[model samples]
Target: MNALVDVSFFPRAAKPLASYRKFWAARFGTAPFLPMSREEMNQLGWDSCDVVLVTGDAYVDHPSFGMAVIGRMLEAQGFRVGIIAQPDWQSAEPFKALGKPNLFWGVTAGNMDSMINRYTADRKIRTDDAYTPGDIGGKRPDRAALVYSQRCREAFKDVPIILGGIEGSLRRIAHYDYWSDKVRRSIVVDAKCDLLLYGNAERAIVEIAHRLSRREPIEHITDVRGTAFVRRSDDDTRLGWFEIDSTDVDAPGTVESHINPYQTTSEQAAGQGTTCSKEDQTVRPEPVEGQAEASTSSARTDAGSGSKPLRFMPNPALPQRVGKQVLPPRERTVIRLPSYEQVKS
Candidate 1:
């Protein structure tokens, strides 16, 4: 079953990946393999890599590999990209192999979630990892994203750590862990990383790299889509953005109904005002004070009752209509998701 919440807001126009001016170090040609050691960096004629990528998979120069795709993309944009694959997680020593990144550290748990790669459907520990050079297991620690991020922090106290790949993406929000048999907090909180990029991260990652190169602080770059981060609940006040209660779309309460948009109009009308029994509804957290409420407009009135239907309307606080055209101003808005406490219950 899928859970959803209605969010009505306009995001600013996204800058194209290739639109940003290339970093100053584009003069250094691409490395056949993003360097895993100082020797490789010296061979590539690089004094220091602008971005260092740490992954749990072996270095394969294939597009299928997350590290390769991201590294190559950044290199094309004129940033020195390096790789530290399958570093020993026993201590922070191996993490220091690439020295400190001039921009930030990109950490991923390889192509697969570490837990799934290391375990079986029956929860038995596996003995092989196909992505590894020798098809070996135990190369990456469980929750490799979190472990690697911590190591990066320890290696360079002030460097930013950006977490991605399957592990960080899947666990970006509170999720039930089959192996752990409990709900886990968002990896953004557990890993203590600066940012978490989910799904196809090329767009967000490119923008982030350029912004950081321009010296924009990571904390101030929160409006990017397909990304999640930890911030105080009260942080939205300064932006003057309205909030949408998740429950407005998904009912709050135990045993909530699943809404299927594909259902027939008659089926929807039949289920109206009655709880759905097929799927559980996700609970939304309560709205905080000082946030604007969603707008509403009157739809058709019921013939029998002579009462108008309350329909969701676009936020009037946004760009106003000029004649028949509505133009939205670039602004930052937030869709409030269920709190970690709510999801756990």
Candidate 2:
């Protein structure tokens, strides 16, 4: 008889690495980021054997830090992970500097385009630190794509370029929205990436890494649960539009349903007004010259302040009382994620 023993391998937990504060301070002259130092790196045992996460975001361990956890998980799976926070994604140098990654993980705070707006907007939010770059009137350069593609190409000209963050996900369809003073569609189509992973990504990312480790082709690994990017012509035609009875249709004469990620669900497709129930729609008094004003004004009035909501209303999808049969209204194919909602179901 022979005794057998099983040995299991588990990667060590990562510790803090070299302080990122010193680097950021030298570059921007202020700290809007938490410090991650070399000593911390050594304690965390981070080495060159990690994946570089190229993104358009500031690295902070906050609630919006889902991407950070994904990176850490990759490191635990025996891959090092470094973040190129909000790099000049137009250029290739920053991405090249960090070396090639096994996977390029992307994410957005809430929406990808919105994130770009917050960072690149002429009027940006002020940080507690008075001398931050935007406060000093530093805005994102016009060449955002150039920077992103350059770094991406430099690192992995042939490696898979994954576009995931908010900017990439929401723009995964032929969306009609202004960008660089023009409208655009299908971010993956524009970015020319190998794949576009959408929604909360921790689980999908790990599966991607595992599959890649086994030398599997990126295209064949679509069984993982998440949106998968494909060429425009390859999408199913049936996904374009559904001709519901006009009278029974809830949202008519609206392109809102076309771009809504949650258009198909029963609850959403049933069509409801704003999430605010009638009881929750009470108006709050606005203070004017040290006195609260009576609530007799319009229920929806914009304050004279600088902040105003930006709204877009596309033209009617179906014409009224058409005598002849026309083309069915078609929208870009999109898979509804949990975060999606139907403005008109």
Candidate 3:
């Protein structure tokens, strides 16, 4: 087997956030605090917000708060940003307080995870939430990210919803739910949002917001880093890609060596049945049970020396199970996880 290659897949040089061309709406200037009510918007001489932030915490214009940081950052880009902090999630009416977001609704569970904020370490209900005004409790519901996202969808059926913050970041993948004692599906799957931004999302959020401003379809904006979205199992438009079984990565096991798509044309021609000479061509392995046909061209590293291999862990939707037929090995690829049903069991 070829030794793993160390490559810088991302650029070392990045344009500063301040250097982005301000949105045309930047002519409106900035608000002392993002408008929270229609009256405030009216006072600011605005008709509707470009982006509405639905958050579980009170609107404190501080970097410590996820909603504020994102809202202010978008505001700097000349987008009319509004806040719907701690809205009544029981109904969609409260979500309409900001009217409709022209761009999209940015939803977050506040600075901390909703479950951690609402529950005690011993699984007892907490009496107060520090994020709320006056240490108030019950301001936000449990699983605020998912609940708020659902309400946003109901309020504006056509508007796009983007989920973020601690709750979203933590639950981006299948993980054991301490409260329920079971592995829960990705929050992106549960929220049904257009996108879930995980980790430091400043760059991704800025790019997404700008792209949406340009009237780009949200569905087509999947390549951004720090974001996750669900796609059909058979969408394999990506070229020059391959797969690796998860078992090989997670547990040490003997595996067959396959030709790297990034190898030179002479090297590729030397390998059996592998002929991905051009960047557009891909080496497709035989379809295995529950595996999707997703593929992408070899990624270029920052050094620009060689193609960076793309490896994806088996999605929870496609797990390798006992008693299942063993699939043949594929070259230059990674395994996809089992479906939620299989993993939840």
TM-score of each: 0.74, 0.48, 0.71
lDDT of each: 0.80, 0.47, 0.79
Which prediction has the highest TM-score against the true structure?
1
List residue ranges in candidate 1 displaced over 4 A.
Answer: 1-10, 234-239, 250-330
lDDT of 3 by residue, 14-87 (tens): 45788889898899888888999999999999999999999999988888787888888898988999999999
Best first by lDDT, ranked: 1, 3, 2
lDDT of 2 by residue, 86-160 (tens): 654455565555455555534332223433444435545433222123433222333333246445766577777
| Candidate 2 or 1, higher TM-score | 1
Candidate 1 lowest-lDDT run of ten: 1-10
lDDT: which candidate is best? 1
Each model's RMSD to truth, in Å? 15.8, 20.0, 18.8
Worst window of 10 by summed lDDT in candidate 3: 1-10
- Per-residue lDDT of candidate 1, residues 1-345 (tens digit): 111211223365767887889899987766677888999899998888899999999989998888999999998898999999999999999988878899999999999999999999899999999999888899999989999999999999799999999898888877999999999877888898888888888888898999999999987877777777777555642365445545554432234568897997556866785445443344656655433232112222235458777765665555443454332333554556776788999
Q: What C-alpha lDDT, on a 0 to 100 scale, does residue 103 get in candidate 2?
A: 53
User: How does candidate 3 score on lDDT?
Assistant: 0.79
Model 2: ten consecutive residues of lowest lDDT: 1-10
Q: How close is candidate 1 to the true structure, as a TM-score?
A: 0.74
